[model samples]
Target: MHSGLPNGEHALIVHQAGDLSNSCANVGPIMAPDKKFNVSAIFGNIKVDGTKNATIDREIDWPKDISLIGRSLVIHKLSVMEWSLRNKDILPLACGTIGFASP
Candidate 1:
């Protein structure tokens, strides 16, 4: 069981050309999924949506534009979720996610 991004899925390189980073730097609105632009650098907000909650790393700096609408969201898993819940902060909610109170 190999984990991590599978083949054909390239990591987003903020410093290079690819997608999801250019428009963010032009001081314009970016709705596309891929491109090179410092999104948070200009826009200031990012939003995502999805049916199942996903696991996300806390070290990543989210795009900041304030116009996040209609996109898939990722949430942390059990062990990670517990760490978040134990701390003082609202856990991020993904699309179509169902959460139960801890026992």
Candidate 2:
């Protein structure tokens, strides 16, 4: 998790924005029906002090369809599914585009 984020049930979503290119800014759900990225990957659930800072140690089962590279990670206020359906354009608390790591 980043150093700046409110403490709550934040979801980690991988959006398939464009044609799987560098301009994929859509930020939609990686799955269908319920736009849930991962319920268990809930951020801010860690125990922290007044500063509300804690590291998130989680192992996610990466889906084949959703590639980490060139994709975007969005953190929403509410549940991923709820926010996607209710709002015209979802507002993410924090977001970042995934890139390849140097070997």
Residues 14-50 of candidate 1: C-alpha lDDT, one tens digit per residue = 2211222332232122135345545421211121224
Assess candidate 1 and give its TM-score to the true structure. Answer: 0.20
Summarize candidate 2's per-residue lDDT along 1-103 as a digit string, tens digits: 6766676545566665423333333565553312454432233223223576744445566555545676566666555456546763546666677787789
On the 0 to 100 scale, the lDDT of residue 51 in model 1 is: 29
Top candidate (TM-score): 2
Worst 10 residues of 1 by lDDT: 9-18
Q: Model 1, residue 2: what's the lDDT?
A: 16
**Pairs in clash, predicted candidate 2:** 18-24
Worst 10 residues of 2 by lDDT: 39-48
Backbone clash tally (model 1): 22
